[model samples]
Target: MTNSNVFQNLSQESMSLDQVFHNIVRYMKQDVIGNYRLIFGTDSQVHTDHTLFITGIVIHRERKGAWACIRKVKVPRKMTNLHERISYETTLTEEVVSLFSEEMKQQLIDIVLPHIYKGASFTIEGHIDIGSGSRNKTRVFVNEMVSRMESLGLEPKIKPDAVVASSYANRYTK
Candidate 1:
């Protein structure tokens, strides 16, 4: 057979999203057994000019292969009640900002794990920017997610900060 013909034939076996979902469920069914439930949660928090959002996608694959479903949970940032206390403080100390960021990230990660494949590997990537005076908290959430995934035998890949910088660097060069 010609190379083109070989490529054509191999392409026919490519699995669709539905097929992959089925396979995942079929692969996971035994662990869940008689009682199985899938849940997903996304949480976010906003402190001053900084916003932290985390999204978790969960897929529950069934043993029989036919009963698998995926759920996406998103958490959005909103103003915090503590704003009242910080209202009078003109500038936030590095320690105070760090604590706030860590707390928010933890809250988001705590909600993501229940919906993931028990032993499947996954990664989370995104960007975060805090205005001149604010500390970026998005990194805290990403790091926490990676740590949690590691505990579950899953490896997480976080994109490097240089990638974002390069994108903007190129924008001005040309």
Candidate 2:
């Protein structure tokens, strides 16, 4: 919801949306053109007085390597309900995915749009923090969240499978 770009890379410098897109393009063209997946996901941690949210964009090149950019924001409001909290996390993920998808579309239009899902082989997926295999209360919202993501044309992945959100983003949520 914040207007300013606040994502930071673990190894390099922080990046704006444009920078992220350019980096991905560079990686795709120089490192792995037809073998990579772009993923967007979010996770959150609720404290007594606030909530910390982390949204991550991961670029994974098949058997080669991976890089991710993360944004961490602290909301003054606290989200306590399990369902509400999980829903909020999914919403955050959606926001990031929307922006990312738009940027990537513009960048890849001339490069791979005509050959989408074919020669280029670039993929975009959304990873939700909720999963069916967990004892966590968020499991109940898996179906709803996945359906929403699917409606947006993003392949949805859940915990165990959605390490981008559950594991990576979660690591920085605190």
Candidate 3:
């Protein structure tokens, strides 16, 4: 199949993942602007059991300007049974939850907000690569970033189906 078609198929099968992610992003934004806090942690126990690295990326865009930030969390390799692996993953998830507020603040003041005055149409993108796990963490990270942007009086544009005809494509193709 063509790359575009492959991406389309993948997107369709991942709708539930997308919804969970959106919820996390929304929560992060609310926690930041409303509570003014920061959150962070490592799911070392889970990583030790799962043998995977979970990385999160938050991309905030405004007009022609964008700021991207990445948070790499190592989920320990699986050292025992499924139960142990699950427990570890759960711990890591909790750690991620804790980091939402603080990370959002740093990303906004340090990266995203500065670009706001430079453009109009703003879009904030977030991705999580849970190598061997799921998309839960990635969605959480993105939602947090989006919320922060909103709190700053910016609206976020999250389009999960525009990969083939994306701005990145237009830029490179031109």
Candidate 4:
């Protein structure tokens, strides 16, 4: 979710997409020979006057360290429809994913190309804030969202595995 085309992390208040890309590159350079996971997710909260959405991007080095950032988007009115809210969250996450062009992805991959034999690898995942568990109201929508993400050529994670959406982004939606 981005209203101003900027994102922020713990250290910076405002950053353009290019800046975020560079930051990701800098972070990966710290350990170019490690496994990398690029994850994106979105969560939303409905308030009296507006609905706040937060999309989180997490660059995780597998069992190693990670870097995360969030983007906020505000809808002018409360969103009470469960399906609509969930659909919008998925859209927002997809938007962030679109920011990574093929060239950029290849650039990141090139960082680990030399050490591929030594376990260096890269993968991208889209974390939807829905689950397929019984008793979960959101379960009904999981397949649709997962299909949408899969169309974008990204692996999808849900619920317990969707830490970026369910845990990180959800925290800021409040």
Candidate 5:
């Protein structure tokens, strides 16, 4: 298994965590008076010999537009166990979120602190790829994963609500 700080999107590649932080700051600064959300999530695809995990980081300007990037991690062996795979995805998401230092977060928060009275706000969310649908196999793990997100002081999202993990990250996992 390998872990790296590099992240990339269609417009940029090989961005260090500091660059990613500045990119997020630049986007938020564009319209400080608007509402915004930061989301982090991860999805994985297991191949015959290894598993590829993609963690997506997105900063949404709430219905206007969003800036997103992803970091990939490759585990040197196939991971077919459902619980293990799901747990790893969540772990990856958490790992990426942890890279943002308290000061970095404060930088983003400070951008909106002044405009809060005008309805501007900022929120952070963690999207876990699991779901709670009774018929879904991942249902059993929903509570555990959501609790993990909550412990990080983030809003937890799953399945239908977790498009970042289930949708954005999943698309490039191949």
Candidate 6:
């Protein structure tokens, strides 16, 4: 959503975040045979000249695996703390989800959220890059990040459980 060339198609076709959302929704509407979950996440890698941040939105269909849309953004600044980096990652994921929600409001209300409200086993979650290993200092930010996601009305996911952010998106950040 930030007017930076932050997102691209798998074929390396560049497009704005709004275009990406519309594309995803078009796919979703065409492939509406099963239950699905919309997951958002972000990951970052620091290089010599800049830090790369990648955000992903994953559409998971029960018993059918998933597919994702990713966006990458680079910043010249560097981050030193686990909490700060993780927090920024959370913000990126949140922004992407916000735009998705805005674009898909009617569809979500009439289709997805209703299933969730009726006790369907579907969810919309935000994944954070923090892990639980003692060797991982990012664990310190897990509680705060989880609370933040909850406040945003999303279920939260952390490392191990957050492959969409920490793994899938991480591939492109580098």
Q: How many residue pairs clash in each candidate?
A: 5, 0, 22, 0, 0, 0
Reference-based TM-score, model 6: 0.83
User: Candidate 2: which pairs clash?
Assistant: none
lDDT of 3 by residue, 103-124 (tens): 6434445432444455322233
- Looking at candidate 3, the ten consecutive residues that score lowest on lDDT are 1-10
- After TM-score superposition, what is the CA distance of residue 13 in candidate 2 from its true location, in Å? 4.6
lDDT of each: 0.29, 0.78, 0.32, 0.93, 0.93, 0.75
lDDT at residue 94 of model 2 (Cα atoms): 78
On TM-score, the leading prediction is 5
lDDT (10s digit) by residue, model 4, range 21-83: 999999999999989999999999999999999999999998898998999999999999999
Deviation from native of the Cα of residue 3 in model 6, angstroms: 5.4
Q: Write the per-residue lDDT of candidate 5 for residues 1-174, one digit (tens) a residue.
A: 878989999999799998898899999999999899999999999998999999999999988899999999999999999999999999999899899878888889999999999989999999999889889999999999999999988899998999999999999899
**Model 2, span 50-136: residue lDDT tens:** 888898888887777887898776778787888877887887787777776665666654455555556456677899988686667
The digit string of per-residue lDDT tens for model 1 on 67-144 reads 222211111333364332122110111112222234433433444345455543223222111112235334434444
Q: What is the TM-score of each candidate against the true structure?
A: 0.23, 0.86, 0.26, 0.97, 0.98, 0.83
lDDT order of candidates, top first: 5, 4, 2, 6, 3, 1
Per-residue error at 162 for model 1, in Å? 13
Kindly report which residue stretches of model 1 are placed more than 4 angstroms away from their true locations once superposed. 1-20, 23-70, 74-136, 161-174
Q: Ranking under TM-score, best-scoring first?
A: 5, 4, 2, 6, 3, 1
RMSD in Å for candidate 3, one decimal?
15.6
* lDDT at 38, model 6: 80
List candidate 3 stretches off by more than 4 Å: 1-50, 62-76, 79-94, 100-174
lDDT of 6 at 146: 93
**lDDT, candidate 6, at 159:** 79
